[model samples]
Target: MPALTLSRGVADWPEQGYDGWVLLGMVTLSLLPVIRLFLQTLNAGSIEVAGVSLSFAAASESAAEAVRTATLTENLDTPEDMPLERTSLRSILRALRRAHDSEVTVVDLRQGQTWWETRLFILIAGAARRDRTQAIAFVGERNGTPGTFLGWAPPSRLLAAHLRSDPLLSAAHERARAKTAAWQLGQPLPNPHASVTPSVMLPWGTNQSLPPVENQTPDPAFAFELYLQQNLDRPSPESGRLVTIQRLRELYEVFLVTDSIDAQTPDDAWAEVVLTASPRRFFAVTKAGKFKALIPRDALVAALVTRLVRAEDSPS
Candidate 1:
């Protein structure tokens, strides 16, 4: 509860002309929000300030007696919903701390709200910078309206598009993004189902898997790795570029991702490009630039081009 002080001898309310009504009006407005806050807390047994909801649920009496409180039950895994207006990183971090306890926190993102999406992007990224490792689950309605659950799984592109601007994560983001582009472009995407982008798009790269590789000489998909191993002693990523390759009167794109070898000085930013036929397929390119046996199977260089062109010409 709060109080508003009235100035004495003010021209707006001179002492002689003052009535109790004016004071009462000012007091009512001041106390209204406090009353609402108090009522909300009383009803929910939780304290909310600045849109972050913090609620503590005590362990069940029966469970307590058995001393079996190691992890929460699935039925009790309810996500604390955040307020729609200006959910701050501090608030999200607070909710995350609560989530480490018995409650999960869910940020409800409305459909097509670019403003909220951008804000959420910053929040998730900030969480990443802080090394927060919790799966961020968002609840979104279909077409921003009342609807049945189309299914629990949403499109991978839904997150990929939103997360494309991350310069820090572009290396990882590009892996799954390549798959998305391959599928949409009707290119040879051997591992479309093996997507880490949806989770990568969020702040959680909580799992690590060995990058797939081919050992045989001239595995064109790994031309970049071979070149790096041969030329550099200690290699590091520098920059990545996408190149359009046309052969036999057909055009295709390859991501010419680059890396810097060990350098002795600050000017050691010299870089070399690694060629990949698909997003995930990194092939080795020789000084001669020949990729005979290295090209991926079932993805014949020229035939695949036709599918890509057809996919592009198709109506959205």
Candidate 2:
């Protein structure tokens, strides 16, 4: 009986030690998160916040000063039908680089505050090829903002009005335009989008299904394809002068009519506008101007116009 009692006691002692070890482990696990938090707080405290300014700030100021020094007419007057000799962009880039005394080269200058780097070359080429005029703005991803501007069009008249209405993008445009050389006005250059001016506006329509003709015309289908490809940034239909669903239906037959095209379905809405004829061609009739069927690329004409209007109307 004594031997049995001793054996039972020994077993009980082992159980107690095992329980103590489990308890100690639980305590350690509970405190670990708190210790981690304390260390993070200490590290955060070591970083000092200072009110540092960018060197570009001074460059921006100087650039603005140069622009303001001239009279409004002299400064604002842009030339008409100016064709790009080399890239007019080069002059502006050089000017900005000189003023800033930094490596600040011209990224894509499509709209206000928003610009692009070299990554957007294909997009720029596509935009330039599609537009005959009023395609000045460069659509590029820059500084986390997606925007537009008059890349080829002179910053005058209707273009100015569009800029005034769009507060967000227009402000950036104002800054960029101010920094640019005054001579860019009348030069024929690449336009990113249409301007409000009737002379420069190019309308895009989805009405590609025009009546059949004897000779086949080269479809401008690539225009819309290019437009869609470059416009990865999902712009809001209500952001600026966006075409309403009803208006779009009435005007063009094709569209990606959603707040964000990049987002997935059931939110996705895309449609194509084909001509009434066989192997349907694309054409859109607009009050601005006729985007001929020879260039199926004209399908994006209205869309680009709408995008420009939206950018011009949006506030910073």
Candidate 1 local lDDT, residue 66? 26
Q: Estimate each model's TM-score.
A: 0.20, 0.16
Candidate 2 residue 3 C-alpha distance from true site, Å: 99
Best by lDDT: 1
- In model 2, how many backbone clashes occur? 52
Tens digit of per-residue lDDT, candidate 2, span 1-316:
3533464587653354466565676676776565445324423332111322212112223332222111111101223222222122333222322323311112232222222211122222222333322222212223444321101221132233333444543443343333222212223334354431111112231112211112332122232222222232225332223222232223222221111111121101111221112231222111112111111212332232233345456663
Task: List residue ranges in candidate 2 displaced over 4 A.
Answer: 1-90, 93-134, 138-270, 273-316
- Model 2, C-alpha of 146: deviation from truth (Å): 6.1
Evaluated at residue 245, the lDDT of candidate 1 is: 19
Q: State the lDDT at 59 in candidate 1.
A: 11
The global Cα lDDT (0 to 1) of model 2 is 0.27
